[model samples]
Each structure stands twice: as C-alpha cells, then as structure tokens.
Target chain A: MKELKILAVIAALVGITYYGIEPYAHSVMHPEVSAADFTFKDAKNVDTSLAGNVENGKVLVEANCIACHAIEKAGHPALMPNADAAASYGVVPPDLSHAGRIYDKNYLANFIFDPVSAMHLSHKYPVGGTKAFPMPSYNWMTPQEIMDVVSYLQSVAPKVTEDKEGHKATFEAACGRCHSMAYAKFDATTPKDSIKAYMGATPPDLSQYIKSRGEHYLHSFINDPQVLLKNTSMPRVGLNEKAQEEVIAYMEEIGDSKKAERESLGLWVMLYTFVFAILAYLWKRKIWSEVH
Target chain B: MAEFKQADSMYEWFDQRLGIDKFVKVMMTEYWIPKNINFLWAMGVLLTVMFTLLVVSGIFLLMYYKPDINMAFDSVNYTIMQEVAYGWLFRHIHAVGASVVFLIIYIHMFTGIYYGSYKRGREMIWISGMLLFMLFSAEGFSGYMLPWGQMSYWAAYVITEIFGGIPLIGGDLVVWIRGNFYVADATLTRFFMLHVLLIPLAILGAIVFHFYALRFPHVNNEAGEFFDFDEEAEKYLAGDKKNSKVVPFWPVFLSKDFFVLGFFLLFFFYLVFFHYGFAMDPINFDKADGLKTPSHIYPEWYFLWSYEVLRGWFFEIAGISGKSLGLMAFGFANIIFLLLPWLDRSPMVKPANQRPYFKYWFWLMIADLMVLTEFGKLPPTGPNAWVGFGASLVFLILFIALPFITKAEAKKVGGK
Candidate 1:
C-alpha cells in the first residue's frame, strides 16, 4: 500500500506536469491560428474573355520586361547583370523563365499591373514615398496588355516534370532568387547585401527548412506570409498549390532524404528489440525458477 | 579453488592463470542481495545499460561528426542522417540514449534516497553516483554544442555566460571555458573533445568506484533490513535456499533485473522508433546564426528544474543583483544533491514509507521539483515568475529544514 502510494504520487506529479500542464502552457503560449487559405481569394480575378496574342505578347515582354527580368529560355539575356541591377534597385529581379509555370496566373497578372499594391507592400512603398518600390507599376497599360505579358511568360516557360529533379527546378525558380540551397550547391541569384537591405534580415538558407519549419507550417507560411507572422518582409511568392508542394518536396529531398529509409528501418529495429526483450524475459524467468 | 585444480580444458587453464573462477565467485555468485527490493532497484542495471548504449552510439556518431562550426551541422544533419546507410538509426539511437539515460539516472538516484541507501557505510556509493550524474550532465551539455544548431549555439551561449556572474574572476572564467569571448569554432572543438573523450573517461572511472563502494555495505533492501551476507550465502549454498534472506547476485538478483531491463528496452526503443521528436528539438534543425536569437530559449527537460531555480530569483536582495543570486541558487541546487548523506540527520534505516515526517518531506521535495521543472520551460513573466519563486523557496526550505525534521524524528525514536 505504501509502495502504491509512492507510485501514485509519482504518476500524479509527472502526469499533471507533462500531459495536463505542459500542453496547457504551450497552448497558452502559442495559440493556434486558423490554417492559411491556399486559394488566392484576395488577388484580382483574371478575365478569361481577354484573349492574348502570343506573338504580340512576346513583343511587349521584350520591350518592357527584358530590360530588368531575364527570360533566358526565350533567348533574351538580361540587359543588366545581377550585380549592376542589385546595386541600382537594392534587389535583383528574378528571371522570368519559370514564372508562368510556378506563379498563379491571376497573381502574376495583378503583380504585373501594380507590384506594390498586389503584394500589399504599399505600407513599405507608398506612392510618392521616398522608399518607393523597385518594380515600377505597369498600371498605365490596359488589362489586355498585362494578360498578354502573363500569357507570353506562360508560353516561354518550360513544363516542370513532377519528380525530385522537377521539384528542384520549381524550388530553384520560386525561392532560389533569395534563398540558397547549400546541399544542392545552388546559390541565391540576389547578392547577400542587396537582399539584406531589401528584406531587413538576411533570408535563411532553405537547405534544412523542411525539418525546421515542418510541412504544415511551410505550407501556411508560403501560402500567405502575413498569416503566420505579421509584418514579415517575405512577399508571398504566389506559387499555385502544386508548385508549392513541389518546392516543399525538393526541400525534403535534400533535407530529409533518408526519411523513408529511417522510417522502414525503425520498424525492423523495433521488432528486433522487441524479440530480444521477450527472449531476455524468458531467459530471466528460467534462471530464477531454481532460486526458490 | 576446486574449479582451478586441473588444466584439463581451456577454461581450467585460464582459471589457473587468471583466477577467473575466484573473481566470478567474489563479484557475482557468492555476492548476496536482499530479496525485499522492488523493480526500482533494477534501475542501477538499467542505468549501466543506458551508459553502454550511449558510449557505443556516441562512437558511431563521432566517426562522421565534424567539430568545425561551419561543417558540424551538415555533417550530422545531412551527411550522416542522409548519405550514410543506417546513420540515421545510429543518430536516433544516440540522441534518444542521451535523453533516456537521464530518466534512468533520476530513478536510480531517487531510489537510493527513498531507501536511505546513502546512510551508514554507503556514503561513497551515493557520492560516486553523484559524481557520475554531474559527469553525465557535463557530457550532455558538451555534446549538445557539437551539432551547432540554433538552440545548440544559443544554449551554449546562455550557459557559458552564467560563469560570468561570479565575483571577480567571472569574466575570465567564461572566456577560459569557451576558449573565446563567444561560442565560436574554438568552443565547439573543445566541447567536442570533452563530450567524446574527457567526461566519458571520468564516468567510467566513477562507475568502477561506485560498484566497488557497494562491496563494503552491500545493496540496500526495500525494507532496509540489515543482513549478514556471508552467513546468508552459506545458507543458500548449503541447500536451504528457501529460508535464506538473501539471493546470489549472479542468477537470482540478476533474473529480476533482466526482467525489468526487458520492459525498459521496449519503452526505450518505442521512443527511438516512433517518438523521437521529443528527443530532437525542431528548433535545432536550423543552423546556428549568432546575429539572430530564437524567440524562446530553454534547456533540455532534464535540466529544467535547476534552470528554473536559476531563473526563479526575479528581484535584487540587499546589494547582490538578482542575476547573481539566481546564479548562486542554481549552483546551490546542483551541489546540494552531493550533500544528501550529511543533511538527512536521520537515525532511521528504513524507507520513507516507514518514517512519517520524512515521507511527506520526500513527497513535497518531488512535487516541488516537478513544479520547478514545469515552470522552467515557460517564459518568466507574471504568474510563471511567481510560481517559480515559490517553488524555489520551498526547495531551499526543504533542504534547510531537513536536518531539523530528521533529528526530531531521531529523538522521538530514542536514538542518536
């Protein structure tokens, strides 16, 4: 009875602390937020009626975008190199090679119309403000012209296959502008100092982000940066659901490549230990039978 | 001697030269243990198994582990966990072993205290065990620095900075320990040396001393019954085993021990396989960046109680700053475990259950420490700070009032 009492006391103390209080404390400290809406509902709707002329769209992109953004797959080299552009604009503009494949169509069209307003970064780069945005608004152009540019980007973009290498390509195009993948030997296109000035903190390398932020967090955070952390400098990359998963997959490929192997081997290791434990129990019982 | 008479077989030849039979007789077969002990007594064997597991797993980790700050995180997280076959298994085993070893150590330590195992001639057993505990803590802390993750870097930064709270030589002491003003490459390399080498060697030596210390007083029983082991061994050997109060260490005592070890392994591997996230913190997955600090920083679960004591003092007392007082309290909390033998002042030899006041004191101590541990991981604000302060005060009062209570009990029993 005394032993039972001691055991009861221990159980109560440990149980209350871990199961009862610890979880309560954690819940209080880190209250749950609603999951991020993957649908870009707030983004401007695309008007499907506006038919884009591919030939005309290519001419417009060459005239307007090629000066800043490179469309290398379309055979148009960037007019200014990254070093010069970063020096002037305080951020290197991303290459438009995979923009149409990775980005949401509506978001891409809206972003082309007004960069600051589309990203809700008007607070940082208000109109006529000293700290104006690097990307000039193309709001003066008609909606048809903006859709044509988006259509041109889609025409030039390569189809990303749905595998590790394909995911790597998507990840590189989507996040590699600012984030480096050290494991993959992929350096960020933007210079460190330029990005640091652009985004307050130096963007963390994404090599181990899969393990760090985890899948669900990365999903919500990537879907909408402001949802998880308010006032975060990260602009929502506006990747569609499929492209986001691909990026996360590529992260898992590099960061936790052995997850499958580790999981399978865990079963076997547990089984072996279980068998050994039973055998040990039997051996112990057999030896003790001669004692009394 | 009869077993060593003839060299007819290889075993006999070895026995003749090395006295293996005699050694086994002295260490195992002829050694007696009380039969009244519970499964908690099995914790000693469980701790030994944990230590052995940790050492074996640590060796495997050391093979591919890089001590350099730049490469250390990748070497462990990427190279070993991803590229090397079965490296993740070894890493998981090592990480889980380092954590579970402390669980077993606490159970073992508490079992000693509950049964008054440190009393009479058993001081060295408790003393040596305490030494092993401290050594294992240092080993854990040093090993925690090797991964060079965000938590690893920050934890090292916070812990090493504690030494700077000392009086005059505090500033130099922190630098001397870190080998730099900050937790840099030098600190990681030196900690790697200590974790993988120095502290483990100390623990091994301490284990030998602990086991040897047990030879003088023998293992304490659950009911704290004193036994004449030599006579008991004779009784069992002379075919009156059922009447013997003691059992041989080899088969009888170890049989029960093995049974407990079986259950422990089931639980241990269950954690390693299915629930290893508790052992490996998610925040530690990010590489170390000294410029940015994590929003919340806390030590591992095992050190939470003492850490809470360190953070418990929120106000200045007289001339000393709260930080200095907190540091002193933290040191006191850790060092007080070593003085358990002298502080109890009890003439009683039985377990806490048999002593009225001592039993409540033991339970209160357990509850208070648990409170401290729970409050430790929380942010020091408002209610958490107050609760932590109350627990810390209880902890101090419990220790300070121990001698008085135990001595009063001794007087009630008409003993010294």
Candidate 2:
C-alpha cells in the first residue's frame, strides 16, 4: 500500500509537469493561429470570356518583362546580368521559366497588377516611404493582356512531374533564389548581402525547417508571411496549393527522410520488446517460485 | 590459491590464470543482496543498463559525428540520419537514452531518500552516486553541443556565460573555459572531446566507485532493515531459504533484475522508436546561426529544476546582483544532494512512512522540484517568474531546515 502510494505521488508529479504544465506553457508561448487563406480575393479579376493568345503574350513579355526579368526556357535572357540586376533591384529577380507552374494564377495576376499591395507588402513600401518598390506595377495592362501573359508563361513553362525532381525544380524556382537548402548542398542564387538588403534580412536556410516549423506552420507561413509574423520581410510566395504541397514534401524529404523508416521499424521493435518483457516476467515468476 | 595444476579446457586455463570462478563468486554468485527490497531497488540495475545503451549508441554516433561547426549539423542531420544505414536508430537511442537515464537516476535517488539509505553506513554509496550524477550532467550538457543546432548553441552559450557571475576572475573564467570570447569553433571542439572522451571516462570511473561503495554496506532493504549479509546468505545457501532475508546476487537476484530490465527496455525503446520528440527539441533541428538567436531558449528537461533555481533569483539583493546570487544558488542546488548523508541527523532506519515530518518533507521536495522544472521551461515573465521564485526559495528553505527537523526527530526516536 505504501509503495503504491509512493508510485501514485511520482506518477502524479511527473504527469502534472509533463502533460499539464508543459502543454500549457507551450500553448502560451506558441499560440495557435489559423492558416493563411490563399483565395486571392481582392485582386483585379481577368475576364474569362476573352481567351489568352500565347503569341501576343510572348510579344508583351519581350516588350515589358525582358529588360528586367528572364524567361530562360523561352530563350529571352534578362538584358542585365545577375550581379547588375542584384545591385539595381536589391536582389536578383527570379527567372520566369517555371512561374506558371509554381504560382497560383489569380495570385500571379494580382502580383503583376499591383506588386506592392498583392504581396501584402504595403507596410514595406508606404505612400511616402523613402525607397520605391523595386518592381513597377503594370496597372495599365487590360485584363485580356494580363490573361494572355499568364497563358504565354504557362505554355513555355516546363511541365512539373509529380516526383522528387519536380519538387526540387519547383522549390528552386519558387524559394531557392532567396533561401538556401544547406542540407541538400543548394545555395541561394542571389548574393546574401543583396537579399539581406532587399528582404531587410537574409532568408533562413530551409534545410531543417520541416523539422523545426513543422508542416502546418510552414503551410500558413508560406501562404502569407504577414499573417503569422506582423510585417515580416518575407513576402507571400503565392505558390499554388499543389506547388505548396510539393515544396513542403521536398523539405520533408530533405529534412526528415528517415521518418518512414523510423515508424515502420518502431512497430517491430515494440513487438520484440513486448515479447521479451512477457518472457522475462514469466521467467522471473518461475525463479521466484523456488525461493517462495 | 595453490591447488590448480593443469588446464582442463580453454576456459579452465584462463580461469587458472585469471581467477574467473573466484571473481564470479565475489561479484555475483556468492555476493549477497537483500531479498526484502522491492522493484524500486531495481532502479540501480536499470541505470546500469541505460548507461550501457548510451555508450553503445554513442560509439555508433561518434563514427560519423563531426566536431567542426561547418560540418557538425550536416554530419548529424544529413550524413548520419539520411546517408548512413540505421544511423537514425542509434541517434534516437542515444538521445532518448541520455534523457531517460536521468529519469531512472532521479527515481533511484528519491528511492534512496525515501528509505533513508543515505542515513548512516551507506554515505560512500550516496556520495559516489552523486559524483556520477555530476559527471552525467556534464556529459549530457557536452553531448548536446554535438548537434550544432539552435538550442545546442544557445544552451552552451548561456550556461558558459553563467561563469561570468563569479567575482574577480569571473569574466576571464568564462572566456578561458570556452577558449575564446564566445562559444565558437574552439569551444565546440573541446566540448566534443569532453562529451566523447573525458567526461565519459570520468563517469565510468565514478560508476566503479559507486558499485564498490555499495559492496561495503551491501544494499539497504525496503523496510530499511539491517541484516548481516554472511548470516542471511548462509541461511539462504542452506535449506532455510524462506527464512533468510538475503539471497545470492547471480541467479536469484538477477532474475528480478532482468525482469525489471525487460519492462524498462520496453518503455525505453518505445521512446527511442515512437515518442522521441520530447527528447529531441524541434528548435534544435535548425542549424546554429551565431547571428540569429532563437526567441526563446531553455535547457534540457533534466537540468530544468536547477536552471529554474538560477533564474528564480530574479532581483538584486543588497549590492549583489541577481545573476551572482542565482549562480551561487544554482551551484548549491546541484550539489545539495551530496550533503544529504549528513543533513538528516535522524537515527531512524525505517522508511519515510515511519517518520512523520520527513514524509511530508520528501513529498513536498518532489512537488517543489516538479514545479521548478515546469516553470523553468516557460518564459520567465509575470506569474511564471513569481511562482518559480517562490518554489526556489522553498527549495533552499527545505534543505536549510533539514538538520533542525531531523535532529528533533532523532531525539524523539532516541526517547522511544
């Protein structure tokens, strides 16, 4: 009875600390927030009746986008080199080769229409802010023109197969310009200093983010950085849901690839240990039988 | 000693030269252990088993583990976990073993205190065990740095900074210990050596001392009864096994030990396989960035209570700063258990249940430690700070009051 009482005390103390207090503390420290909505509701809508013309879109991209941006898959390189572009724009602009596959359509349209407001970056570039936003908004383009540009980009974009290569390609296109995957031996394409100046801080290496921030948090944070962290330098990446899933999958593959192996092996280890425990208990009982 | 003439077999040849049979008799078969002791006494054996697991797993980890700051994080996370075969299993076992070994150590310690095993002749055993505890704590702290992650970097940074609280040479002491102004490459390499080599060897030596100390007083029983080992072991070896309170260590005592070990392994491996998240902090997954510190940082669970004791002294008393006072209190809290043999002056040999005040004291100590550990993890702000401060003060007051309370209890026991 006394031993049982002592056990109860220990169990109670351990339980209250681990289960009760720890969770309570964690809840306070990391208060849960709803995932960011990726509806892109407020963006100016493209008229669905007018079908996009890829040829017109190509003409438009050459006229408007080529001076500053690149569509390497479409054989139009940026007029300015990466070093000059980084110096000028504060970061090397991403190549538009996989933009259509990676970004949500509505989000991309909105981003082009109003680069400042679309990325939830109004706080960074205020009406009377000292520095101008790097990318100029193409507000004059009609809805049909915008749709055509989107279509052209999509047509030239390499098809992203649902596999490790696809995920890696998507991640590199979307995030690798700014964030490095150090574990995968992938470095950010843009110079670190330029990125620091552009984003107000260099983006963290994404190697172990899956383990640290976890899947749900990553989803919310990537969908809209400002929602979780007020005025975070990180812009909304505007990855489509599928693209987002792929990015997260790639992160997990890099960071926690052994998770499946660990889980599968756990069951076998548990079974073996359980059988051993049962046998040991029986043997203990048998040995004690002689003494008793 | 002079009777052996020729080798009967390979084993006998070795035995003739090595006294293997005599060694087994002294250590196991003829060695006596109390039969009346319960499963709580099994904690010592469980601790040994866990130590062996840690060492075996640690050896595997050491094969691929890099000490350099540039490669350490990748060596652990990428090379070990992803590249090497079954490396994750070994890492999980080592990580979880390091954490769970403390749990068994705490249980063993509390069991000793509850039964007053440290009260009289068992002082050396208790002291040697405390020495091992200190070594294990050092081992855990140093080993944590091998991952080169956010928590590891900051924990080493924060703990090493604690030395700056010392007077006169304090500032230099910190830099000296780190071998630099900060916990950088030099610090990491030295801690790597300590974790992998120095502290482990010290711990092995201390374990030998602890077991050697145990051999003298033998093991105390559940009822805190003292019996002559030779007398009871004779009864046990004769036909009066049922009447004897002692049994031989090898077959009879080891059967129970192995049984308890089975259940312990079940719980331990369950942690190593499934519930290992608690042992490995998520923040630690992030590679260490000296430029960017995490928003919140705390030590591992085992050190939380003492850590809280340091943090709890939140305000300056007189001219002495809270940091200095905290550092002293933290040091005191860590080593206070070593003084337990002399602190409780009560002559009573029975368990805490037989002593009125000591029972409440023991339970209260357990509860206070839990509170300290819990609050230690939370941000030291507002109510958390006050609660921790109160608990820490209570912790000190309890130890301070021990001699007086036990002295009065001793008088009463003597009167009875």
Best by lDDT: 2
lDDT of 1 at B338: 96
lDDT of 1 at A159: 89
DockQ of every candidate structure: 0.50, 0.61
Candidate 1 local lDDT, B335-385, one digit each (tens): 998999999898788889788678999989988988898899888899889
Q: Candidate 2 lDDT, tens digit per residue, A50-126? A: 67899999999889998888888999777686778889888888899999888888888778878888788888888
What clash pairs does model 2 have?
Answer: none
TM-score of each: 0.92, 0.94
Q: lDDT tens digits, residues A27-67, model 1?
A: 66566777765556676644535877778889899899887
- Poorest lDDT segment (10 consecutive residues) of candidate 1 chain B: B1-10
Candidate 1: C-alpha lDDT: 0.85
